[model samples]
Target chain A: MSSNMMTEVLNLQANQLNAGASASLEAVLNAPPEARAELSALMKLAARMKRWLIPVRPSSAYRARLRDGLQLAAGHQETHRALVETRPRVPQWGWLIGAAALGSAAGIIAMILRRRQTRKDASVAESAR
Target chain B: MEAEEQLIERAKRDATAFGELYERYVDRIYNYIYYRVGNHADAEDLAARVFYRALGNIARYKQRGAPFAAWLYRIAHNLVANFHRDAARRREVPLDDIVAVAEKRAGPSQIAEQNEDARVVLEAMRALPAERQQIVILKFSEGLSNAEIGKLIGRSEGAIKSLYHRTLIALRAELVKRGAE
Candidate 1:
């Protein structure tokens, strides 16, 4: 009849479906005769759909082959991952070189200042004489 | 026996553990792909790929309260989608394939009737949207409950019910249309 009525009917059917099998059957049995037939038909349709596509087992040969392939691949992946995790961490070369250069410059500057002071002291001593 | 979660955890680092997980799910995944693609060769290829990809990414898998099977189904769903996109072609389920399935049970006359019905329904299924097709396959082929289906597809149970109801209606309409033709 009306769209809202149709929506309500569909909602009722959906609720029944979500309730699982025994409850659904109980719902169907208790439904008014007028609605029962349609609901029953829908349920039959679902069952028929299941029957229509019978689950076919994959060939044993293919299954075995795939299993072997996956095992090999997994072994390789595990090895790679282990290598990555266990590998030693390398020191950052840039920072090490920079620190060494800074130390050498500081040492040279100190030596130059000491030499200047010594020369100044010698000049002072000569003047006193 | 260790719980599935522990097995999956071990599987993340252990190849033998991963192999155990594969044994548990390979058939269901194969059947799912078979229904989707309607052929043995492609189903086999895709099913293998699903496991291979899962093995490659197992370390990234987290236990988010859903079953591990849900994760595998999600992978299968995506790969099937990609397959359709790449092929850019409609499915053509050969009669022989339907016959082979039907032959698994029933007499000759019953097999004949089943083959026709299977073909008709499969053809009608193709006309439905992709989501609807997946719902049907998960519900019918794998016998998953609506809640399980919802978990795999990342939908609420209520949403799955609504979709399932709508899907049946759509299938009926399609079947009627085909009958009229």
Candidate 2:
């Protein structure tokens, strides 16, 4: 059989399986007689594959433990969130830091000017004397 | 959905509400992780982390009409990927573990045969590309539709169908190469 025909058959079988319909070995009606056995094998294999990965539940102990853990973590998170919501909002640290730097620079400049004035005043006093 | 959304809204600010959400999705997320990792211990740990991360980021969660479970699946997916990366090796599913989960009433010989087949199938499954492995797990283990799997993996439904078909083919080839009937 041509590859396209084979692909068509496989895809038809896939569509059936995906739709939650069982793809029995005899389900490949469109395939040529020569390819029917191979197509049927593939379909049967796909169905068996689905059954192999059966859904297994987590143990009750693990489930309860994880739930408790989430609760505790969520409690901490809620407390932190509440604190954030109720706490007074502060200005951005960048703005506050910029203001502090400007203030420090101004203070330093003022001190330097005052010292220069005092030195000038003392020199003037000496010159006057 | 309104109830779930209201629960999610409350969960953002209330711990107990989040607990309700936890109860609803714990099994599903666990089952997804269990199949991906093929073990319970790692599945439990990863499942716990998924909820923790989800809880931490609940405040940022927006209801965009995608199911809330999708977001949790994303978390589980990322963690499982990291687990594989960190382990730095592919771990085979223990045949005994698979057998233990089999039907209890089966005779010892039948159970042994079933376990061997399961082991072969799981080995082939693990050998597939990561995306294919994920497709198989979500489809078979979680019973998600192609559209649902597409949404979870950010693919269109058509893309999911193609990928799933290819995955099955690859799995069959792998099984045949392994001498599995």
lDDT at position B20, candidate 1? 94
Q: Which residue pairs does candidate 1 place in steric collision?
A: none
Q: Cα lDDT of model 1 overall? A: 0.81
| lDDT digits (tens) for residues B1-181 of candidate 1 | 6689999999999999999999999999998888888888789999999999999899999999888988898899899888878865556777777888685668889889878888888778867887899888887676677788898888998787778778888888888888821
Each model's DockQ score = 0.36, 0.47
TM-score of each: 0.74, 0.81
Interface RMSD of 2: 2.5
lDDT of 2 by residue, A58-115 (tens): 8888888888888888888878878988999887999989999999999999999999
Least lDDT summed over 10 consecutive residues: which range in candidate 2 chain B? B87-96
Which predicted model would earn the best TM-score?
2
Could you give the interface RMSD of each candidate, to one decimal? Answer: 3.5, 2.5
Each prediction's Cα lDDT score?
0.81, 0.81
